[model samples]
Target chain A: MYAFFIRTFEGSKTQVELLKEKIRQDGKVLSEEVLKVDSFLNHQIDPVLMQEIGKEFVARFSDQNITKIVTIESSGIAPATMAGLILGVPVVFARKRKSLTLTDHLYSAKVHSFTKNESNDISVSKDFISNEDTVLLIDDFLANGQAALGLIDIAEQAGAKIAGVGIVIEKAFQPGGELIRKAGIRLESLAELQSLQDGKVQFVGEEAF
Target chain B: MYAFFIRTFEGSKTQVELLKEKIRQDGKVLSEEVLKVDSFLNHQIDPVLMQEIGKEFVARFSDQNITKIVTIESSGIAPATMAGLILGVPVVFARKRKSLTLTDHLYSAKVHSFTKNESNDISVSKDFISNEDTVLLIDDFLANGQAALGLIDIAEQAGAKIAGVGIVIEKAFQPGGELIRKAGIRLESLAELQSLQDGKVQFVGEEAF
Candidate 1:
């Protein structure tokens, strides 16, 4: 039972702005290609921030009839679970490893991690995802879009309709955002980074959206 | 801001009972040793139930002066993040892999997954946990206690004081519960299973608690 607050989304700094501000303040610029947000996103998480991100995701994708929230293991689980909490949907995270319990009747795809330069098979039990479900895919970061694409592949394998893709951070300089958009899938990246070059953080700018 | 409800913890089914009821209704007993709860806990998560689990954990450990909530990757991240949100603390999940950005100045521990029949070197960045902190370690399931012990080892390696350990479910037949209790740390397992033999879930029961 939630008390409804008549809070409008106008005349205020958006959740996207707050997330970008947090990134600017705490995100580590490792190089032009890498930005480490270990302080709040991946390694160590700020739960309040995650909850805010979740709300933002739900607001952005509210139009879609999302029956389930699908995400990859580890980082994606936090924000996905949070959004699933608010939306009253189940969250399924695809495991990168072949766990002993998950033996058969699975929908799986190979996700190539560009950072680690290795391919890992990510899987979802067939019992979780099905053709009748319209799934909203979520992830912490979208770089080359390998993980997102892998999720899409898995969802398609189950003959499920994809509602959209929600990403916490999207590197605009990379091909991920373009690829997803070109594929005619709805993609919402909360903080779209233009560049992490010159040991500085640069956003794609608010007007670009 | 939350509306304060002074609801007493009496004259109602306990959080543990609710969790056990859900388990009994949905859990699949693969054998006497394994109870698959993928429908709600792991693989696929029930977000509302996870939030309840989080609140119960916070209520149980509210007096511990906890500064951080720590857990392993994947399954543990969801419930741990939920607890972190309620407690106003950071949830630091130890990475099961040596990620590219996570190279140096780390606290590492080897966790052997009996299910996978393999060992993974789980690591945490040195920047997260410290001696000044008191961490509450959380997990979805406690079987052999290998994962919990590994977390304790990592937290101890950083000189962080162990406030307590919280588990969503504990196989009372397993050594994990006893091992943690013998170490003199407060252990709160929401649902304790007495047995899963012959494909039936038997709880340790409310009177035992």
Candidate 2:
């Protein structure tokens, strides 16, 4: 059994610290490269805690008039939906596979998952977002930024203005953080992990949360 | 654009009636066999409407002392997470595809999606549920009972008590409702559709909800 309350950072009291604590305690680290939060956030979810993560995202991006929040299918839907609830906005997730029921008119983009070693097309209905909409993109983890870029591509296709991006955990060790910042997208990550050294999780921008 | 009623169902009569109204108005019928609620529920999610759906679910299953709300990954995560928020319990979704980070210890099940015309292995981390758990399964739609049956099987594998089955929409024309009811599962669907015929959605037990 995983002891979920083990705090890694003794004095760091930010949401980032608490989140890192949860990861260190409950997250299953299959390898030095793969840190799975399936026990708490993705596969096995803690909604009450995730809802707090949502409020934290809103707290960070409250100044922006985010009319809609968009995320990719599967894991992102949980926290992003919660953020939509806290923000009083709607949430739309891009479908990874085209369903028989989905309409033909859609904004499609290609996303390559570095972790999965696979590439696929993700799409959103053309009618869900429009030119007037200001959308915030949110996701569970940002590693390679392929999925977030796909979301950005879809939002731009709909002519919607990019409000910002919210990420639950950012692997700053990867290119996602760099690419997003390089693109000038206003991105806020609740917990940013700098490295996983000898089964220990390190952090970036500790004071910024 | 999909018109999201900026009213987060506030001052709305009740979740059931509001959900039905939204379905009647915004739900699309691509064919007699296909009824798509992508505009509001599945594809483009309305957080306020979904939150109310969660509350209505809790009202239905409140007395059961549900320990965990279980769902399949992807679309089910949205409403299930909200229900967890309302119930103040944790949520767990079975993963459709095994990722590298997933643990080898798991309860596996095969689910055939009637919509997708594909069958794959869906598994949940064995640690997520146990013999003491009373699990409640929630999903976006119940047409074949195949998916829910898979979940039930997984719960049973964990020796967890079956609290009940909750569905957002049930295609009554299909055998899913009867099979679940016949098994004596306390099956509750917010909206039960009798048929989707001639570009129309017919409902059974409408007034009861």
Best by DockQ: 1
Query: Which residue pairs collide, candidate 1?
Result: none
**How much does each candidate deviate at the interface, measured as C-alpha RMSD after superposition?**
3.1, 7.6
RMSD of 2: 6.2
**Cα deviation in Å at residue A209, candidate 1?**
18
How big is the positional error of residue A83 in model 2, measured in Å on the Cα after superposition?
A: 0.9
The sequence of per-residue lDDT tens digits that candidate 1 reaches over residues A1-209 is 12132132334867787788889889989988999999999999998788788889989987888999999888899999988987879999998963334557988888888897888889999999999999999999999999999899999999999999999999999999988988888999998888876788888864321
TM-score of chain B of each: 0.90, 0.89
DockQ of each: 0.62, 0.50
Residue lDDT tens for model 1, B1-209: 11133122234767776788789788889998999999999999998788778888988998889899999887888889978987779999998863334558999888887887888788889999999999999999999998898899989999999989999999999999988888887899998889887778888863321
Please list the C-alpha lDDT of all candidates, in the order they appear: 0.86, 0.81
Candidate 2 collision pairs: none
Q: After superposition, how far is residue B45 of candidate 1 from its true place, in Å?
A: 0.6
TM-score of each: 0.92, 0.89
Docking class of 1: medium
- lDDT, residue A169, candidate 1: 96
